[model samples]
Target: MEPNNEQAQGLYRLCYRLTNVIYPGWQYRPIQLVRIDERTGNVYVLAGESDFEIKPTGGYEP
Candidate 1:
Protein backbone atom coordinates (compact mmCIF):
# COMPACT_ATOMS: atom_id res chain seq x y z
CA MET A 1 0.00 0.00 0.00
CA GLU A 2 2.61 2.48 -1.11
CA PRO A 3 1.97 5.69 -2.98
CA ASN A 4 3.13 6.02 -6.54
CA ASN A 5 5.60 8.66 -7.74
CA GLU A 6 2.88 11.04 -8.85
CA GLN A 7 0.93 10.61 -5.61
CA ALA A 8 4.07 11.18 -3.57
CA GLN A 9 4.90 14.31 -5.55
CA GLY A 10 1.41 15.70 -5.12
CA LEU A 11 1.58 15.05 -1.39
CA TYR A 12 4.89 16.88 -1.24
CA ARG A 13 3.39 19.87 -3.01
CA LEU A 14 0.48 19.86 -0.58
CA CYS A 15 2.86 19.74 2.39
CA TYR A 16 4.85 22.64 1.00
CA ARG A 17 1.80 24.84 0.58
CA LEU A 18 0.38 23.99 4.00
CA THR A 19 3.73 24.52 5.72
CA ASN A 20 4.17 27.85 3.97
CA VAL A 21 0.89 28.99 5.44
CA ILE A 22 1.71 27.82 8.95
CA TYR A 23 5.40 28.81 8.83
CA PRO A 24 5.78 31.59 6.36
CA GLY A 25 8.83 31.69 4.09
CA TRP A 26 9.50 27.98 4.52
CA GLN A 27 11.43 26.37 1.69
CA TYR A 28 10.84 22.71 0.97
CA ARG A 29 13.60 20.37 2.03
CA PRO A 30 14.27 16.72 1.28
CA ILE A 31 12.64 15.65 4.55
CA GLN A 32 9.35 17.41 3.95
CA LEU A 33 6.29 15.34 3.08
CA VAL A 34 2.69 14.70 4.07
CA ARG A 35 1.70 11.63 6.07
CA ILE A 36 -1.82 10.29 6.30
CA ASP A 37 -3.56 7.63 8.30
CA GLU A 38 -5.61 5.65 5.81
CA ARG A 39 -8.10 4.53 8.45
CA THR A 40 -8.64 7.76 10.36
CA GLY A 41 -7.92 10.32 7.62
CA ASN A 42 -5.49 12.12 9.89
CA VAL A 43 -2.89 14.13 8.00
CA TYR A 44 0.46 15.26 9.33
CA VAL A 45 3.00 17.55 7.71
CA LEU A 46 6.72 17.42 8.23
CA ALA A 47 8.20 20.28 10.21
CA GLY A 48 11.78 20.45 11.40
CA GLU A 49 12.62 17.33 13.42
CA SER A 50 8.99 16.44 14.01
CA ASP A 51 5.61 16.38 12.30
CA PHE A 52 3.27 19.34 12.66
CA GLU A 53 0.14 18.15 14.37
CA ILE A 54 -3.05 19.46 12.76
CA LYS A 55 -5.43 20.21 15.56
CA PRO A 56 -9.01 21.46 15.31
CA THR A 57 -8.75 23.91 18.23
CA GLY A 58 -8.29 27.39 16.81
CA GLY A 59 -7.32 30.85 18.05
CA TYR A 60 -4.42 33.27 17.89
CA GLU A 61 -1.50 32.28 20.04
CA PRO A 62 1.79 34.16 20.14
Candidate 2:
Protein backbone atom coordinates (compact mmCIF):
# COMPACT_ATOMS: atom_id res chain seq x y z
CA MET A 1 0.00 0.00 0.00
CA GLU A 2 1.14 3.50 -0.81
CA PRO A 3 1.45 5.93 2.02
CA ASN A 4 -0.16 9.36 1.80
CA ASN A 5 1.77 12.60 2.14
CA GLU A 6 1.12 12.98 5.83
CA GLN A 7 1.92 9.36 6.53
CA ALA A 8 5.09 9.56 4.51
CA GLN A 9 6.17 12.70 6.32
CA GLY A 10 5.39 11.18 9.68
CA LEU A 11 7.30 8.04 8.83
CA TYR A 12 10.29 10.07 7.67
CA ARG A 13 10.28 12.03 10.89
CA LEU A 14 9.99 8.88 12.91
CA CYS A 15 12.78 7.26 10.95
CA TYR A 16 15.10 10.21 11.51
CA ARG A 17 14.47 10.26 15.24
CA LEU A 18 14.74 6.49 15.55
CA THR A 19 18.01 6.45 13.64
CA ASN A 20 19.52 8.94 16.08
CA VAL A 21 18.36 7.12 19.19
CA ILE A 22 18.76 3.50 18.12
CA TYR A 23 21.78 3.75 15.87
CA PRO A 24 23.55 6.84 17.02
CA GLY A 25 26.54 7.99 14.94
CA TRP A 26 26.07 5.14 12.48
CA GLN A 27 25.75 5.99 8.80
CA TYR A 28 22.17 4.97 8.15
CA ARG A 29 20.86 4.62 4.65
CA PRO A 30 17.14 3.91 4.62
CA ILE A 31 16.39 1.14 2.17
CA GLN A 32 12.60 1.09 2.18
CA LEU A 33 9.42 1.09 4.12
CA VAL A 34 9.20 -2.51 5.18
CA ARG A 35 5.85 -2.37 6.93
CA ILE A 36 3.35 -0.21 8.71
CA ASP A 37 1.35 -1.80 11.50
CA GLU A 38 -2.32 -0.94 11.13
CA ARG A 39 -3.10 -1.69 14.75
CA THR A 40 -0.27 0.30 16.27
CA GLY A 41 0.26 2.85 13.45
CA ASN A 42 3.92 2.06 13.71
CA VAL A 43 6.16 2.27 10.64
CA TYR A 44 8.98 -0.19 10.01
CA VAL A 45 11.85 1.29 8.06
CA LEU A 46 14.73 -0.87 6.92
CA ALA A 47 18.09 0.81 7.29
CA GLY A 48 21.21 -0.48 5.60
CA GLU A 49 24.00 -2.11 7.61
CA SER A 50 21.85 -2.71 10.68
CA ASP A 51 19.21 -5.09 11.98
CA PHE A 52 17.52 -2.89 14.49
CA GLU A 53 13.75 -2.52 14.70
CA ILE A 54 13.34 0.94 16.15
CA LYS A 55 9.87 1.37 17.57
CA PRO A 56 9.03 4.87 18.75
CA THR A 57 7.35 4.91 22.14
CA GLY A 58 5.44 7.69 23.91
CA GLY A 59 3.15 10.40 22.41
CA TYR A 60 2.13 8.11 19.56
CA GLU A 61 -0.47 5.42 20.28
CA PRO A 62 -3.03 3.92 18.00
Candidate 3:
Protein backbone atom coordinates (compact mmCIF):
# COMPACT_ATOMS: atom_id res chain seq x y z
CA MET A 1 0.00 0.00 0.00
CA GLU A 2 1.01 3.58 -0.47
CA PRO A 3 2.51 5.42 2.47
CA ASN A 4 -0.24 8.03 2.44
CA ASN A 5 -2.86 5.30 2.39
CA GLU A 6 -1.24 3.62 5.36
CA GLN A 7 -1.19 6.91 7.18
CA ALA A 8 -4.81 7.54 6.33
CA GLN A 9 -5.79 4.13 7.66
CA GLY A 10 -3.96 4.77 10.87
CA LEU A 11 -5.67 8.12 11.22
CA TYR A 12 -8.98 6.53 10.36
CA ARG A 13 -8.50 4.03 13.17
CA LEU A 14 -7.83 6.89 15.54
CA CYS A 15 -10.96 8.67 14.38
CA TYR A 16 -13.04 5.52 14.83
CA ARG A 17 -11.74 4.95 18.32
CA LEU A 18 -12.53 8.55 19.20
CA THR A 19 -16.07 8.24 17.86
CA ASN A 20 -16.65 5.13 19.92
CA VAL A 21 -15.68 7.04 23.02
CA ILE A 22 -17.84 10.05 22.15
CA TYR A 23 -20.76 7.94 20.96
CA PRO A 24 -20.73 4.62 22.73
CA GLY A 25 -24.22 3.57 21.67
CA TRP A 26 -23.77 4.09 17.97
CA GLN A 27 -23.12 1.49 15.31
CA TYR A 28 -20.14 2.12 13.07
CA ARG A 29 -20.13 2.30 9.32
CA PRO A 30 -17.06 2.35 7.11
CA ILE A 31 -14.61 5.19 7.35
CA GLN A 32 -13.58 6.87 4.13
CA LEU A 33 -10.94 9.20 2.79
CA VAL A 34 -12.90 12.04 1.25
CA ARG A 35 -9.83 13.88 0.04
CA ILE A 36 -6.12 14.53 0.49
CA ASP A 37 -4.47 17.88 -0.05
CA GLU A 38 -0.82 17.12 -0.69
CA ARG A 39 0.26 20.74 -0.79
CA THR A 40 -0.96 21.27 2.73
CA GLY A 41 -0.46 17.66 3.85
CA ASN A 42 -4.02 17.44 5.05
CA VAL A 43 -6.15 14.32 5.14
CA TYR A 44 -9.92 14.51 5.17
CA VAL A 45 -11.95 11.61 6.56
CA LEU A 46 -15.63 10.82 6.88
CA ALA A 47 -16.88 8.70 9.72
CA GLY A 48 -20.62 8.33 9.55
CA GLU A 49 -21.89 11.95 9.77
CA SER A 50 -18.79 13.25 11.51
CA ASP A 51 -15.92 14.73 9.53
CA PHE A 52 -12.26 15.12 10.40
CA GLU A 53 -9.31 16.96 8.93
CA ILE A 54 -5.93 15.62 10.06
CA LYS A 55 -3.02 17.99 9.65
CA PRO A 56 0.60 17.01 9.13
CA THR A 57 1.51 18.73 12.37
CA GLY A 58 -0.48 16.06 14.31
CA GLY A 59 -3.87 17.41 15.30
CA TYR A 60 -7.46 17.16 14.21
CA GLU A 61 -9.61 19.97 12.80
CA PRO A 62 -13.18 18.97 13.45
Candidate 4:
Protein backbone atom coordinates (compact mmCIF):
# COMPACT_ATOMS: atom_id res chain seq x y z
CA MET A 1 0.00 0.00 0.00
CA GLU A 2 1.19 3.48 -0.86
CA PRO A 3 1.30 6.07 1.87
CA ASN A 4 -0.22 9.51 1.42
CA ASN A 5 1.92 12.63 1.08
CA GLU A 6 1.38 13.65 4.67
CA GLN A 7 2.41 10.27 5.98
CA ALA A 8 5.43 10.21 3.74
CA GLN A 9 6.54 13.63 4.91
CA GLY A 10 6.00 12.67 8.50
CA LEU A 11 8.05 9.53 8.08
CA TYR A 12 10.92 11.36 6.44
CA ARG A 13 10.91 14.10 9.04
CA LEU A 14 10.89 11.52 11.79
CA CYS A 15 13.80 9.74 10.20
CA TYR A 16 15.82 12.93 9.88
CA ARG A 17 15.14 13.82 13.47
CA LEU A 18 16.15 10.40 14.70
CA THR A 19 19.37 10.39 12.71
CA ASN A 20 20.48 13.98 13.10
CA VAL A 21 18.67 16.15 15.59
CA ILE A 22 17.90 13.48 18.19
CA TYR A 23 21.13 11.51 18.32
CA PRO A 24 23.87 13.47 16.61
CA GLY A 25 26.59 11.99 18.79
CA TRP A 26 25.52 8.39 18.56
CA GLN A 27 26.51 7.25 15.09
CA TYR A 28 27.13 3.65 16.15
CA ARG A 29 23.61 3.28 17.50
CA PRO A 30 21.16 2.66 14.70
CA ILE A 31 17.58 3.85 15.00
CA GLN A 32 14.47 2.67 13.25
CA LEU A 33 11.19 4.51 13.04
CA VAL A 34 8.08 2.42 12.64
CA ARG A 35 4.72 3.88 11.96
CA ILE A 36 2.83 0.91 13.34
CA ASP A 37 -0.77 1.99 12.52
CA GLU A 38 -1.34 5.53 11.40
CA ARG A 39 -5.03 4.81 11.10
CA THR A 40 -5.09 4.06 14.84
CA GLY A 41 -2.33 6.56 15.74
CA ASN A 42 0.14 3.86 16.78
CA VAL A 43 3.72 4.95 16.22
CA TYR A 44 6.90 3.55 17.71
CA VAL A 45 10.67 3.91 17.79
CA LEU A 46 12.74 0.76 17.97
CA ALA A 47 16.40 0.61 18.84
CA GLY A 48 17.01 -3.13 18.68
CA GLU A 49 14.19 -5.43 19.84
CA SER A 50 12.85 -2.98 22.40
CA ASP A 51 10.61 -0.04 21.64
CA PHE A 52 12.35 3.23 22.61
CA GLU A 53 9.76 4.38 25.09
CA ILE A 54 9.87 8.11 25.79
CA LYS A 55 8.52 8.92 29.18
CA PRO A 56 7.01 12.26 30.19
CA THR A 57 9.95 14.53 30.91
CA GLY A 58 7.90 17.47 32.10
CA GLY A 59 6.61 18.59 28.76
CA TYR A 60 3.44 18.60 26.68
CA GLU A 61 1.99 15.40 25.18
CA PRO A 62 1.43 17.08 21.88
Report the lDDT tens digits of candidate 3 across residue range 1-62: 12265556657666667556566665665566566776777777776677878766545666
TM-score of every candidate: 0.36, 0.39, 0.51, 0.41
Cα lDDT over the full model 2? 0.53
Greater lDDT among 1 and 4 belongs to: 1
lDDT of 3: 0.64
Q: What 10-residue stretch in candidate 4 is worst by lDDT?
A: 53-62
Arranged by lDDT with the best first, the candidates are 3, 2, 1, 4
Give one digit per residue, the lDDT tens place, for model 1 in 1-54: 344455455555556654564665655443465565565444456655656533
Error of 4 at 12 (Å): 0.7
Clashing pairs in 2: none
Give the best candidate by TM-score: 3
Q: Supply candidate 1's per-residue lDDT for 4.
A: 48
Supply the TM-score for candidate 2.
Answer: 0.39
Clashes of each: 0, 0, 0, 0
Rank candidates by TM-score, best first: 3, 4, 2, 1
Q: After superposition, how far is residue 34 of candidate 1 from its true place, in Å?
A: 5.8
What would the TM-score be for candidate 1 when compared with the true structure?
A: 0.36
Judged by TM-score relative to the true structure, which candidate is superior, 1 or 2? Answer: 2
Give candidates' CA RMSD values in order.
7.9, 6.3, 4.6, 6.9
- TM-score-best of 1 and 4: 4
What lDDT tens digits, residue by residue, belong to model 4 across residues 10-44? 55554555566456653333465554444544345
Among the numbered candidates, top lDDT falls to 3
Per-residue alpha-carbon lDDT of candidate 2 for residues 1-62, written as tens digits (9 for 90 to 100): 45556666666665675456466664546555467666655555656654333244422222
